[model samples]
Target: MISVEGILFAAALFCCALATAGYLISLLVRRVALAKISTWILAAGFMLLTLNLLVAAVHWTGWSSFGSRHFLSIYAWVIAGIYLGLQLKTKTRLLGAFIAPFILLFLIAAAGQGADRNLVPSQWQGGLTTLHLVLAIAGEALFVLASAAGAMLLIQNNLLKNKKPGPLGRLLPSLGDLDQINHFGLLWGFPLLTLGMIGGAVYAAFVWGGSWPADPKVVWSFAVWVFYGFLLHQRLAIGWKGSRMAVLSCLGLIVFLLSALGIRFCLATVHNFI
Candidate 1:
């Protein structure tokens, strides 16, 4: 007997998959109308997933819930919220073609993981831990989006610099627009990332008694931090822009994903394996 929640989740997954397919098709045809439709459909799917997350939250308690929510629930919503924000603020419909597939995969993975039924915090790590986690995810989300924007910028820059844009190139935003988005994304994402790292440092000291670098999670976090820090330094000191910034963001995104999302897949993080 399938519960109502299960049915809703299935429907949501279906919708997400459909949206991904539609967006992919849009890449070939470049229909603004279809792109808009895909966006709405993706939003509808995300809404259903949000409902599912709330239902799961009602069923769980303790840090277990928080941990599980981090892996299965919170991250996807954060990314979706980011793309939606990008959609609202800019004429970035082209991103839908690339972004939708990623969302579909994330949501599909989320659905498969199911919600953890008892994730309430079991210790007194302080309110700061909760705040830290929230901040950490926010920063990671920003960086991820910035990275995506960076990749787009690079593609657009390369196509333009060569004086011969390809067919797929037609689907991309102008280099100027991509450059602007990368700049803004980094402008906002970097600060949030810095705060996340600081909050994480505090949490680590309180929890592990200064046993910081030993944890793989912390190691990866620092690795990503260093990468982005270097990017920022180059951007400011070297006057890096356009292609250089785009490439840096591309590398930065790769590091961020492997650390924040991929590390969990290895069963190596406190956030639980999804």
Candidate 2:
């Protein structure tokens, strides 16, 4: 028999799927009504995802729900929550076309991986891990938004360069707005990620008596941080924007994907706790 958590997970998936479909249709059909419907549906999906996480946390430790598989699910939840909040503040419903698919990808991965128990050691559980994870996930969620914006920017750029504001292009957010999202994402995500990495180092020193574990995840994570740091420097100091910024953002997302997922599948690491 399916458990309550399972039911909630299923419902969340269904809602997110519907939201993605609605957003995709909105892009194709050029309809504000459809975009509004998609926004509400996405909001419902985010709420259900939140409930599912809450239920899992209640059954265990609040942070313990972040097992290998379930962690991606939580990441999806974070992305949705962040996107919804940003959508409200920025009123950029058109970003759903790019963002919704990312949520779906994470959700589908979660569904495939199924549920699993968190493997956090007793000695490792506390405020340190919680802070590290929360900050890191929040940072990554912002990167998710940035990547979405970068994608939309590329699409819009292509259409504009061709002097064809096609129906789909017409449905996209303005180039300026998308660039702002990209800029804001980098501006906010960098500091949080830096703090989170520092927190992780501190936690490692406390638990394992060493700061650097030479773990694959840790190494790749550092690389991702450095790459983004360089990107930020270029954007801020060098005033890079337009296609270059968009391309780099897209490339950054690719590196992030490999760092986040590739290490999990391809290499053994001490960071496998999630």
Candidate 3:
């Protein structure tokens, strides 16, 4: 018999899968109406996932049972939630074609992980650690949105440059709107990530003392933070926008993602749970 959590997870996954198909179809066939419908379907999946997480939390005996599965589940949830929230203020519904696949991928990854395995460890479980995870995941979710918007901007720009913006170009969001989403993402994501890192650093000081900074995960995280900061700085101070900023945003996300995979799998680090 399937548990309530399992039922919710399965239901949410189904919704996301259907929504992904809908969004992809909307993009391929230039059906804006279908994309709008897909948005509601994706929203349903997000709500179901929210309930699933709450139910899972009830069984979590402290943070010790919080495994990589839980982490990825929450990560996917944040991404979905943020993307849906942005829809209220931006007309980037078509961009769901880019975003839904990622949400689906994270959920699929979560499904493959050991649900009961401990990821945070006993010694590191606390309010500060929780804050670090939440804030960092939220920040990263925004970055994902920024990259999606940036990616779309690139496609739209390419179509415009070639003077062949077919029906799809008309369906895409305005370049200004895309750039604004990218700006909002960088502006808010940077501060949240910085605060999350500070919390992590404080916790590390208490747990790992002077040697924490030397850890490969810590080092890579700091480097990513620095790179993220530079992108934010360029956007705000240097007045960068349009295709250039869009290109950099896509590049930043790709490099950060690739290096993150390398660090997680290849390096010896205390953050192995993630």
Any idea what lDDT model 1 has?
A: 0.72
Least lDDT summed over 10 consecutive residues: which range in candidate 1?
116-125
Per-prediction TM-score: 0.85, 0.91, 0.97
lDDT of 3 at 107: 93
TM-score computed on alpha carbons, candidate 3? 0.97
lDDT tens string, model 3, 1-274?
A: 6789888988899999999999999999998999999999999999999999999988868877788888999999999998999898777899899999999999998888877888887888899999999999888888888989999999999999999898989999988899998898888989999999999999999988899998887887788889889998888899889999899889888877887888889988888865
Candidate 2 clash pair list: none
For every candidate in turn, the CA RMSD to the true structure comes to 2.8, 2.1, 1.2
Which wins on lDDT, candidate 2 or candidate 3? 3
Taken over the whole model, the C-alpha lDDT of each candidate is: 0.72, 0.85, 0.90
TM-score of 1: 0.85
Ranking by lDDT: 3, 2, 1
Better of 1 and 2 by lDDT: 2
> How many residue pairs in model 3 have overlapping backbones?
0
Q: List the residue pairs that clash in candidate 1.
A: 61-120, 62-119, 62-120, 62-121, 63-119, 63-120, 63-121, 64-119, 65-119, 65-120
Which candidate comes out best when scored by lDDT? Answer: 3
Query: Model 2 TM-score?
Result: 0.91
Best by TM-score: 3
Superior by TM-score: candidate 1 or candidate 3: 3
Give the per-residue lDDT of model 2 (tens digit) for 140-225: 88887888899889999999999998887877888999999999989899899999999989989877786466788888889889
